[model samples]
Target: MALAATVAGAPVHAQDSDWLSYRDAYRGMVAFEKYGKPKQFLQQHYQVGARDGSPLPVDFRLALSGKTMQLNLPLDAVGRAVFPLLKAAYDENAVLTVNRKLGAYVFRPRISIVVRPDGVYEGAELRAACEQALDFQRTVNAAGYRDKHCVGVRFTFAKKPDADVRWKGGAPLPAVPGPAFPDEAGNAYSVVTVRFDAATDKGQVVSQNAPLAVSPVFE
Candidate 1:
């Protein structure tokens, strides 16, 4: 909430820039923090991904630094970090940096469903969460989202073949190689996308291995 604000029309060019302005990133994210809507089941993360759709380096990490504060933000396998909303950092106009000299990387805010510790998720609950995300998206920037609809959720797992995501007491959901988050680069992981429909809405999804993240799919 302490981020100085920007919105849809803000520039996101990354052609020659090596680092991202934390003030700009915060402005984009503060909308979610200020949104008074149903978002209990969703979470936001600061994401850094390759601009050219290339796979991220194995040691990829984000750095949040300011005049008085220097913090290392470790990225998950998919390049997401739990962004710190610090008033001091905002006051000093911190910057988010990747490995020095690292280019072709872009930064954005990501929203996804909260992963449950038990690896069990109710289908209806998933639908509700997706709706909540979609609704909130419209409040800030409704451009492409104005006519879109939530169709399903995509669960991205580790970069391996044996992800083991399936419907409760049913066959495994077919998974394809894809990125863990939207607009991300590289098909580095197995992704199982479950559609919201009568056959699945009343059931449950059981993930044998914990997913890196589950994102709502809008179409």
Candidate 2:
């Protein structure tokens, strides 16, 4: 008799736990506490363009339970190196899935912003201008994002726009802030808001999220 090697179901190459933790693939500066491992992976594979220091906060889910990613890189040998680190990040018995198109996993719906310029548009007028754009009919399809129509609203201005603008915007835009806008002084930059679990497919004003202002004082 000859012994044969075989898998029980469809030659399963990998296994993942029944429950996978949800993750957001943010484009902007995200806190390393909840997404520590994923950030580490991005830092290690710096070429992936995941951490380009862009103001546009993109969001998506990680292949693993918000910790690691698995890939069967037959053609891309370099990708294989990232596996061990990703695998170890999760639990010993925690099942993981192999995501081939890891890049696609990151979805940037659209970086819609109120171009509140740096010059005269610094304060109230900036907010007024942003209001026009926000009030416009630019729809954002948040299918790729876990939260439907949850937007990472960015208010571009040399100075803070009316805080009231943070609570404004439509269903598709979800003009919600990422975090609380800091009162710290520096060169002008955009304010990003973190909006979670918005229940609309279009930009609906989510007034709850606070804004986080990012000032770039490049030396």
Tens digit of per-residue lDDT, candidate 1, span 1-219: 222235632225454566677778787878788889889999988776776666678877678989999999988767778888888988898888777444566567788899999999999999999999889878877785799899999998875566777889989889888887655657777889888887767899998888988999988
TM-score of each: 0.89, 0.20
Candidate 1, which segments miss by more than 4 Å at Cα?
Answer: 1-11, 100-102
User: Cα miss at 201, model 1 (Å)?
Assistant: 2.9
Candidate 2 local Cα displacement, residue 72, angstroms:
25
Top candidate on lDDT is 1
Residue-level error in angstroms, candidate 1, position 176: 1.1
The lDDT, on a scale of 0 to 1, for candidate 1 is 0.79
Question: Residue 12 in model 1: shift from native, Å?
Answer: 3.2
